[model samples]
Target: MSSYSAPLRDIRFTLFDLLDVESSFARLGFDEAGRDLVDPMLDEAARFAGTVLAPLNKAGDEHGVRYDKDSGSVTTAPGFAEAYRQFTEGGWSGLSAPAEFGGMGLPHVVGMPLEEMINSANLAWGNFPLLSHGAANALQHHGEDWQREVFLGKLVTGEWTGTMCLTEPHCGTDLGLLKTRAEPAADGAYSITGTKIFITAGEHDLTPNIVHLVLARLPDAPAGSKGISLFVVPKFKVGRDGAVGERNAVRCGAVEHKMGIHGSATCVMNFDGAQGWLVGQPHRGLMAMFTMMNTARLGVGLQGLGLAERALQNALRYARERLQSRSLSGPKYPDRPADPIIVQPDVRRMLLTCKALVEGGRALGYHAGLQVDLAAHAGSEEERRQADDLLGFLTPIVKGCLTEWGVECTYHALQCFGGHGYIAEHGMEQLARDARITTLYEGTTGIQALDLMGRKTMQLQGAGLKVFLGMVQAFCEQQAGNAALAEFVGPLAEKAREWQGLTMAIAKRAAGDPEEIGAAAHDYLFYSGYMVLAYWWARSVAAAEASSQPQAFRDAKRETARFYFARILPRTLAHKAAIETGPAPLLALDEAAFDA
Candidate 1:
């Protein structure tokens, strides 16, 4: 079993010590429940994850999920239902939900650390309720009054779960090619007919009901994405009195056998003339779906962070206890038969890399959370718009960069475990496998790159990028004289400038050549991701330096920041060079070029 503890020290450092979340909350008009509440909240969440959720993680992976096609029901791994019940009963499901829907109405900053804990404990189990929170977010934002009344409370309480059905066998990213149909019925409802694949939490026995936020086309809808419509199709319809009623027309056709996250039931759902209500405006379903998707994307990024944390914990524990050959300098521990593996430089390097990336990722994720909170609750309209734009710009970076780095971090942590890492018993292999899907799902890394470069960067005519650059510039200017952080801040500022210039160059070249944009998109996004993470590391280093703490904490922050800049941030140079090279070289090769 993998023994995992929440990084409470780091969490406290990030929340109160570094960000002063309490003061930020006060400025935002938060009530008497101030910063003092954060410690207890975090302690309670850590206990739940470490004791309740973490114990079931290995068991869930071993047991996987079984689907009964004849009965059209899904049975999750053992203890999952009970675990979910405990989670909901503890009011965790309502952590960040709106107060109007019976939720705790906490800010995203408050919910972020809890989310990291849950996902680290068990991603598969975490996903079941995670989607529900996301669905509630979409519904609360765009649902009609009746829809909110009917669905929000139960969803917030976890009596109901939710799924987003967008992918089909024929179309996953290209929603314009979707063939699902939604026909209007006489009663102010539509009958949906289609098959949705790769639907997580699509069908499960953990909740009383499952609500699917599906996308389909109207009979007279326009062609492509513009014609898409969103719907709320329930499993086990609700009665007028809010009781569970007849089963809806939607049913799980089959569940997929995936590479990882087996405990999360990925289902093929068949909507056979199922009754569903259109959400938001007609022909504006894509916009409504995005409202949920953007939030879910951020959730996915946290998932990556959580998995990386778990992997690091396992590796760090194993390295300290395992015996290995003597150190190059001498036998450091003469009392033992052999020295511990952690004394080795390469091993330290691996552990340090995980530490740096995970902590840096946490800072970035929390910053994004703060932006989201401000966007929702800021006093001024101008503040709200700026917050919204900042959040929008960082969303893709959070989703893409965190997830991509998550895989690398886990893989390196596994390498730290040596031969045992590849085996199933140590749990490192499972972490790697589970982390793999984070990049592929919730929109692939490639999709995120395209969004960052094309839609987010170019489409806005650089408005979002300019705002982001201004923030970095302001941070650099403010921290210029901090001798302790000069080394970290200066290099990061230079890299940010380099990235900005590269982005402008790409944008210019893309204007003349469409293919250049597509070719350069992935590398450009990565460059942006590295710089963002480096900038986050710089901010964290400065925050840590100001704290009254042990030299070890300050030393660790400075060391990790050094590792990121020296080893990790250099990749941006190559990425920038690739983007500057343009797409002509890539597009010039024909199919016959591979005929060797």
Candidate 2:
């Protein structure tokens, strides 16, 4: 069975050392979120995750959840309910939620590392509380005052759970094509009727109720994406007195037997005149739901990171112990019959790849989390806007690159174990299976690429891109005289210029041929991601050098950063080349000619 330790040191390094999160939080007016308060919480979370949650992970995967066909209810894998009880009792459910809503009111940056630990410990069980974060966020931002007053506190305190019910059988990516109906009902309530597919945490016994943020259309609403509206539908109705009432019209038709995360209930939900309340203005549900979807997208990226981190830990531990053929040069462990695989150059290559990606990815992901706080709590309006813009630019890059890298790193870690990695005994394959869904969910990588290329960069005229480029140029200029960073700063400066020029090149081509954007979108996203990783890797090296950290730690960071720059960053060349090729290669062939 696989095991997990929270990688607490690395997380601390990312937050306190690299990002200076304490000062960042202080400046953002988070008085109680300093290291003195947050450090103990981290320790407690680590203990809970390692001792309680990690032990349940393998069994959770093997046992999965028990779905009662008769009752339309889901019983989570063994120990999941008790763990969630402790999770809520520990106040982890509301770690970053607003204080007035029964939350700890900590900074979002603080919650991110906790998220990483929970997910790494047990991704399936983590799903139990996952959507509550997004649910509370949506309610806090866009829900009616009465709606927030009724629902937000329960969600924050984990007295209940939540879900995002967006997909239908006929619609996955195209929300505009959804046919769920919401009719006018008494007391400003909505009568919702439709079927929603692939609803994560849709129906479970872990909590008293499940809050569903569903998208539907009204009778007079416009056709297509414009008419969509969001609703808060509960499995068991809640009365105005804050008491649980009779069952609503929503029921889980079936639970999907999935490739992975079987402990998570991916349910097919049927809502037959369920009583829901409108969240925001009519015909503007999609806008409100973006509040939830964006939160979910970032959470999914953290899932990828957490899974990869666990996979790497097990692979590294196994590599050092698993004896194999002698090293080509000579056996380092000649005292034994054979050498551990770590001595082999090729094995080292795979490990280094995992290290570079996972560590580099932690930097990128946490920085994005910090940006989330900056966007919300920064001192000045311009600073907040700039931060928000930078965050928008970084979101797709973090989600797309981290998830894709999660898949890549997991496979490499599995490969490091050779055939044993393929077996269920070691738990590597479980991680590989779990990692598969991250890329597919919360918007697929292709969808993220298109979002980045089409909307954020093109329609908005690269506002976020400009903000990020400014950071890159400023960092490069500040470090120009530092000889240790000269290697990275010079190339980084050049890449920043090339990135701007590449954007201009694509814009020019896209203006003439609209298909150019779609053609270049995927490559452009990966290209942007590689460049972004390069920036974080460089900053990591700088942070390592400037810290009073141990020599070994500093050296590891420098070496991994060097490895990233030398080996991985060059992938951008291929992406850039593909982006330059335009639409002909992708669109040239006739649709009917494929089979021929």
Which is the leading candidate under TM-score?
2
Ten contiguous residues minimizing lDDT sum, candidate 1:
236-245
Could you give candidate 2's per-residue lDDT for residues 111-226 as a string of tens digits? 99899998899998888789889998998999988788899999999999999999999999999999999999877788999999999999988887899999999999999999
Q: After superposing candidate 1 on the true structure, give the runs of residues whose Cα lies further than 4 Å from its correct spot.
A: 239-244
Give lDDT for model 1. Answer: 0.88
Per-residue C-alpha lDDT of model 1 across residues 1-596, encoded as one tens digit per residue: 66679999998888877777888788787774476777898999999999998999999888889999898899999999999999889898888787888888888889999999988999999889878877888888888888899999999989899999999999989999999999998878889999999999999989878999999999989999999999999997654345667889999999889888989999999999998888898888999889889888999999999999999998999989999998999999999999999999999989988998899899888888899898999999988888888888888889998898789889999999888899887899889999999998889999999998888888876666777788889999998998878898788788778777888888788888888879988997888888878887888888887898688998888889899999888988798788878787787889788785
Evaluated at residue 137, the lDDT of candidate 1 is: 82
| RMSD for each of the candidates | 1.4, 0.9
Local distance difference test, per candidate? 0.88, 0.91
Best by lDDT: 2
TM-score of each: 0.98, 0.99
Angstrom error of the Cα, residue 95, model 2: value is: 0.3
